[model samples]
Target: MLAAAAAAGAAIWLTTAWLLNTADHAREGTDRAKVRVDAVRTGLAAGAGAGAAVGLLLAFRRQRHAEIATTLSDYDAAERRVTELYNAAAEQLGSDKAPVRLTALYTLERLANNDPSHRQTIVNIICAYLRMPYTPPLDPTREADPEAAQRAAARRYHAVRGNARPAAQPTTTPNPNEERQVRLTAQRILLDHLKFDARVPWNKLDLDLTGATLLTFDLSNCTLSSARLSGATFHGTTDFRGLNLAGEARFDDTIFSGLTLFMEATFAGSANFGRAIFSRQTDFGGASFSMQTSFERATFSNVTNFGGVTFSKSFSFNGATFAGPALFSQMTSSERATFRGSTFSGYTEFNATMFKRDPAHELDETTSGWFDEFGELVFSRAADFSLATFSTEISLDGAIFSGDVSFRSATFSGNADFSKATFKQAVDFADAAVADLSSPPTLPAGWRIEPGEGATGLIVNT
Candidate 1:
C-alpha cells in the first residue's frame, strides 16, 4: 500500500509539472505569460511538497502495521506454547505414580508463574487434588501381627546360616509414604504462592477445600476472597493468624483436632463456624469482624480465648458450648452481641469487656435499646463481669447461674435487666453503677439491694 501511495504521488507531481511547462511555452512572449510561468512554477512546487508529505505518512503507517502484525504473530506463538505446557502438566496429574503427580504440581506452578492469567485455574486444580479422598498407607507387617512377623523373619534369618542368604527385613509399602509426600508438596506449593510478598502471589483466590482432610493447615498472613472448608478435618495445628478474608468464610461442621489460632485476623464479610468443633486450645484474640459473626452450636473442648476481639456487626454464640475456660476480656461490640442459650461449663470471664452503641451509628435510634443479649445463658462455673461496661441496655433475662457470679464495680450506663434470671448460688453486684434510676434494673426474686449514700447507688445480693 505504501508503494502504491508513493507511485500515485509521483504520478501527480509529474503530470502537474508537464502541464505547467507546456502552458509556459504556449505564451512565452507576453509579460503576463512570465508572471503566469512563475506562478505555475510555485504551484508545481507546492503540489510536489504535498505529494511527498502524503507518501511519508503512508510509509509510516505501513511500518506501524507491519510491526503490529509481527507482535500479534509472536503473541500467538507464546499463547500456543503456554497452552501446550498447561495441557501436558494437567495430564501428568492423572498418573497413578506419586512422583509423576509431584512433577505435575511443580510444572503447573511454573506455568502459573510465567502466565499470571492461569494462576487461579492452577490453584483450583491443586486444591481439587487435595480434596480427593486419600488415606495414609499403613505398614503391612504392622497391620498383620507385628510380633509374629518379626519372629518369622528372625527364624528365617537363623535358618539361612553360613551357605545361604539371610531373610529380608520386613518391608513397609512405599506407596502411602510417596503419596503423603506428594500431598505435602501440593500444600507447600499453595503456601509458597499465597504469601504476601511471594514472587507470584495468587491474590484473593477462592479456596474450595470442602471435606478435605488436611495436615497442619496453615494460611496465616494470607489474603483470601472466600474459603469453603465445610466438613473438613484438620489433623494438625491449624494457623490462620493475621488472615484477611474479603468474602464469606465457611467452616461449618469442620473439626480442628489440634490447636487453632486466628489471632489478629480480619473478617471483612460474614463468618460462619456453626457446629464446628475445636478439640484443643482455640484463640481468636484481637480479631476484628466487620460483618456478622456466628459461632452458633459450636463446641470448644479446651481453653478458648476471645480477648480484645472487635465485633463491628451483630455477633452470636447461640446454643454454643464452652467446655473449658472461656475468656472474653476486653472485647468490644459495636452492634448487638448475643450469647442466648449458650452454656459455659468452665470459668467464664467477661472482665473489662465493653458493649456499646456507636454514637455514629444511625441504625439504632433508641439509646436505651438493649445491645448485649445473654438471655437464657447458663454459667456452670464461676462467672465474672468485673469492670465490664455496657453503654446500652443489656439483658441477662432468664439466665441460669449454678456457680458464684460477680458484677463487682461494673458500669451499666443504660438499663441492666436481670428479670426472671435464676441464681442457684451467691450473686454480687457490689459497687455496680446504674445510670438510669428512673427505670432501674430488676433483681431476681428474694434478692436484696443495699443502697449507698442517699439514692444514687445500690448494691444487690441474691
Candidate 2:
C-alpha cells in the first residue's frame, strides 16, 4: 500500500514540475500526459484506503473467536466443580458419624439452592436418607403399658411380614437420639423446598418416603405431585391439614401412634388409607376426594370425624372398625359410599349426610327443608347406624333406605322426620331414643319410638 501511495505522489510532483516548464501554448502531448498521471495517483490512494479497512476487519474476527473460546472453557470448569461437590456430599451421607451426615445434608441443600436444575435430584437423595431403617426412642409412659406393648408387637410383626424394613441396623450404627437429629434435619430440608417460599420456591417435587419411620411429622399447607408413604409409621401426632395432593396419596398400612388431623385436604387422585391405624382421636373433616378413596379395614380407636366431606367417586370403608364415637355429618357422595361389614362400636351420627349428589325426594316426605336444599338421603345397601346419636335437629325426609336398614339403639334430639321413607325390607329402630316427647319425632309405619338406653335413649314401637 505504501508503494502505491509513493508512486502516485511522484507522478503528481512530476506533473507539477512539467507544467511549470511548459510553453505558454504547450504541445498537446504534454497536456495528455498530465491527465494520465492524475488518474493513476487517484486510483492508487483509493486502493490503499480499502486495503487498510480489510486488515482491521480480519483482526476483529480473530478477537471475537478468542473471546468465545474463553467463555466456553470457563463454563465447562464451573460444571465440573458442581459435579465434584455433589458427588462428595452424596458419599458423605453414608458415613457412620452423625455430624458428617448432617454436614452432607446441608451441603446438598446449598447446592440445590444455587442450581435449580439439581433441586429434584437433591430432594430424592434426601428422601432416600429418610427411608433408612430407624427405631424411635423409648417412651417411659408406654414402657410397661400392656396396650402399648401389644401395639409395638403388632407393628414389628407387620413390618416383618410386609418387608417394610431391613433385617436390622448393624451394631456399629450411631446413637438413636443423635441419629434422630440428623433425620429431622433431612426432613426439614425436604419440607423447605416442598413448600412455597417466594425467595426460594421449587415446584413439581415427588416424594416417596415409603416405610420410613417419622417422628411427629407434620406437613401442612403444602403441595405435592405424588406422595408414596405406604407402610410408613408416624410415631407421634401427625398433621396434614390443608394439603393439596395433585396425584395419588398412598398411606396403606400406615400407623399413626397419636392424634392425626387431615382437615380440609384435597386428594385429586385415589387416596388410600387401607388398614391404617389411628390410635388416638382423628379428624378428616371437610376433605374432598375427587377419585376413589379407601379406608378398608382401618381402625380408629378414638373419636373420629368425617364431617362435610365430599366424595366424587366410590368410597369404601369395608371392614373398618371405629372403637369410639364417630361422626359422618353433612357428607356428600356422588357415587356409592359403602361400609359393608364395618363395625361402629360407639355412638355414630350421619346427620344430613347425602348419599347421592342429585336425587329426587318424595313429594309427601315430611323431612325438613334442609334436605331439599342439598338432596335426598338414600342408603343404597344395608347400613348400620346402630348406637348412633343425634346432636341437633335432623331430617330423614324424602329418604330411601333400600336394603335392610338397622337404626337399632339410635337416639334423636330436637326434631326428627321419618315421613315418606321407603324401607325395602325389615326396617326397624328397635331401641331408639327421643329427646322431647312434647314434640315427638316423626316415625314411619312399623316403626315407633320407645325408651331405649341412656337418659334420652330410644327404642322402636311396632
Candidate 3:
C-alpha cells in the first residue's frame, strides 16, 4: 500500500512541475491572458494532487496500524484460551467422574493440537496429570451385577474347556490381570513428556508444583519443555536425572526436603528456581543449560553441588542463599554469567573452568566473564559481585572472564585467594572487604583496587 501511494505522489509531483514550467514559458513568449489561465490551471491541479497523495498515505498508515492491532489481539486471545484449557485439565484430574476426566484430557489435547503457541503448555499439563499417582487396588469379591459376572465366567470357561488346555489352568487369552497392567502402563507414558520443542510459540509453559507431594516422580529421559513447579513439595527424592527440557522450567516457592537429583540433565532451555528451598542436599553435577538459567532469591539449606556442570549459555544467581557448603569447582559457561547479590555460607571453588564468548564475536569488544589471577582466569565477561558475601574461603585459582569485573561492596569472611588469576581488563574491587593479612592476596599486576578505610585487597601469600 505504501509503495502504491508513493508512486501516485511521485506522478502527481512530476505533472505539477511540468505544467508550471509550461506556464512560465508561455508568459515569456505567448499572450499574457493565456499564460494567466495556464498558471491558474497548474496551481489548482498541484493543490488537488498533493491533497490526494497526503490523504492516501494517511489512509495506508492507518490500515497498517489496525492490522497490527488485530494480529496482536488474536494472539492474546489464543494464549488465554490455551491457558484456560490447561487449568481445566488440572481440575478435571481431581474430579471423581471418569468421563469428565477423559473429556478434560481430550480438550487439552485439542487445545494443544490447535494452537502452536500452547503446544508446550499442553504437554506440561498432560505430564502433570500423568505424574499424579491415582491407582487403586481392585477387589474381585465385589459383584455389582451378578448376572453379568456369571455370564463372563461361563464364556471364559467354555473358551478354556473347548480348547486342549487343562480345566484347572486359567484362560491365557485376554488375561484380566493384564487389564490393570495395561492401564498402569498407559499412565506411565506421561513421564515421556519431560521437555518440549522451543520452536513452538509460547515455548515456555510456566509450571506450578505448589503443595504437590510425590513419593518419587521419576521423569527419566523425559522432556519438560516449560514446566512450572511453584510452591510444590516433593516429600521423597524426586528423580529428574537424565532429562531434557527446552523452555522455561520454573521451581519457584517450592520445597524439596529430600534428595533432588538433576544429574546428567540437559536444559537447552531457561531454568528458574527463584525463592525455592532445598532442605536436603541437591546435586546438579553434570547438568547443562544451553540457554539462560537463573536461581534468583533461592535458599539452599544443605550442600548443593554443581561441580562439573556446564552452562554453554547465559546464567544468573542473583540474591540466592547457600546455607551450607556449596560447590561449583569445575563449571564452564560460554556466555554471560552473573552471581550478583548472592550469599555463600560455605567454601566456593571455581577451579579449572573455561568461560568463553561466542565464536562469532570472539575478538570484538566482547570479553569473557570467567578467568583466574596472575594471568590465569575469574569470570569471563562483565561478572558482577555487587553486595555478595562469602562465609568461607573463596578460590578463583583457575577462573577466566574477558570483560570488566566488579567486586564492589562484597564481603568475604575467610581467605580469598585470587593468586594466579588474570584480569583481562579493569578489575574493580572498590569498597570490597576481605579477611586477610595487610599485604593482601596477590592480584593482577596492573589491576586497580579502590582501597577503602582499612580495606585490604585480599592479603597476599596468606
Candidate 4:
C-alpha cells in the first residue's frame, strides 16, 4: 500500500511541474500553444486528486502498524511481571503473616498454567497447613510479658512458612510415649513424601519400625541414617540402591521379591534378617555389609548376585535355598561365615569366592549333616565349582551333589568329591560321568589310586 501511495504522489508532483512550464511556453506564442496549455491544466487537476487519496491511505496504514506493535509490547511486559510476582510471593508465603500466605497461594493459582514448579510448592504448603490442628487455644495467660505475646504470634506465623517449631519447655515431666509419638509422626511424614516421589533425600532420618509392612517399597537413592527398620518386610521389587544406612539397621522377617537391588549400599552396625525370603532375582551387587550380618533362613528364588560384596565380620546364611542359579563370583567373606543347610537348585557358582578358614574344607567334617542326610552330594545341574578354594574340611557326604561338578583342573587342597563320587576317582572323568563306569575308566592307563598313600579308600581304575 505504501509503495502504491508513493508512486501516485511522484506522478502528481511531476504533472504539476509540467503544466506550469507549458503555460509559460504558451505566453511565448509557440505553434499550438493554446491547445498544449489546456491539456496541461486538465492533467494537473487529476494529479492533485490522486495525491490527496494516496496521502490519506499512507497515514492510516502507519497508524495501524504503530497500534499493533504497542499492543504486543504491553502483552510481553505483563507476562514477565506476572512471572516475577509469583516467584516472590511463593518464596515468602511460608512467612508468619496469614495474609501474605493467602496472597501467595492466589498468585500461584493464577500462574499455574505458566509454571508448574511454583504451583506444586504452593500445593504442598497448603496441605501441610491444613494438617495442623488449631488446638490448645492460644494461651494468653501464659504470656505474662507483653513482648511474649508478640513472640508467640511470630512463631505461629513461621509454622506456615515451613519452618520447624522451636522445642518448647515441658509444662510437666514428659512421658516416653510422647517422644515415641513425635518419632512416629516424623516417620509418617517421610512415607508421605515417598508416595509423591520416592527419590526424596531423607538424610539423618531416624525411624522406629516396630511392626511396619514395607511391602513393595522403593527407597532408591535414599539416605537412611540412624534408621531402625526392625521386623519389617523389605519385599517386592524394593529398591534400596546406593543407600547409606548408618547406625543400627534391622530386618528380621523381610521378604525380597523380584529384582531387589541393594547396589553399592553401606550397612554400619548390626543388620539382622533371621528368616527372610528372596523370591526372585536379587542383586546385592557391590554392597558393603559391615558389623554383624545374619540371614538365617533366607530363600533365594532366582539368579542371585552377591558379587563384589564385602562382609566385615561374622555373616551367616544358615538354611537358605538357592532355588535358581546363584553367583557368589568374586565375593569377599570376612570372619567366620556359614552357609550350613542351603540347597542350590540350579547351577551354584562359587568361582573365585574367597573364604577365611579351611584349606581342604570337607563337605561333612567342618559343617555337619549337610551331605550325610541327603545321600547324593547334589552338584548335578552344571555346577560352576571352579577355582573356589575352601579353607576347612567341607563335606558333601550324603546330599545328591549331582550334575557335572566341574572339578576340571580344579586344585582341591583338601578332601574333594570324596564320600560317594558316583564316578570313580582317577577315572579322569574330566568330561565323563558315572554312567560310563562299565567300560575301562576314561583315565590314562598308568594313572592309579596310590595304595597305602594318603589318597585312601579312593576308587581308582588301576
User: How many clashing residue pairs appear in each of the predictions shown?
Assistant: 0, 9, 58, 33
Error of 4 at 458 (Å): 17
Residues 350-433 of candidate 2: C-alpha lDDT, one tens digit per residue: 656655432332224565332211014444455566655543344554555656666666656545566755677666687666
**Which portions of model 1 show Cα errors greater than 4 Å?**
1-62, 136-174, 362-370, 445-462
Q: What's the lDDT for all of these models?
A: 0.83, 0.74, 0.61, 0.56
Instruction: Candidate 4: list runs displaced more than 4 Å.
Output: 1-203, 225-227, 234-236, 357-380, 409-417, 420-462
lDDT of 1 by residue, 313-341 (tens): 88899999999999999999888889999
- lDDT for each residue of candidate 4 in 96-207, tens digit (9 for 90 to 100): 5555555655565456435444434433443343333222213322435789778977877787687777657457532333323332333344444333244332235444
The per-residue C-alpha lDDT of model 2 at residue 200 equals 76
Model 2 poorest 10 in a row by lDDT: 368-377
TM-score of each: 0.82, 0.65, 0.43, 0.45
Q: Which numbered prediction scores highest in TM-score against the true structure?
A: 1
The sequence of per-residue lDDT tens digits that candidate 3 reaches over residues 389-413 is 4433344655554566666655554
Every model's Cα RMSD, please?
5.2, 13.4, 17.4, 17.5
Q: Rank the candidates by TM-score, best first.
A: 1, 2, 4, 3
What is the clash count of model 4? Answer: 33
Query: Clashes in model 2: which pairs?
Result: 367-397, 430-460, 431-458, 431-459, 432-458, 432-459, 433-457, 433-458, 448-461
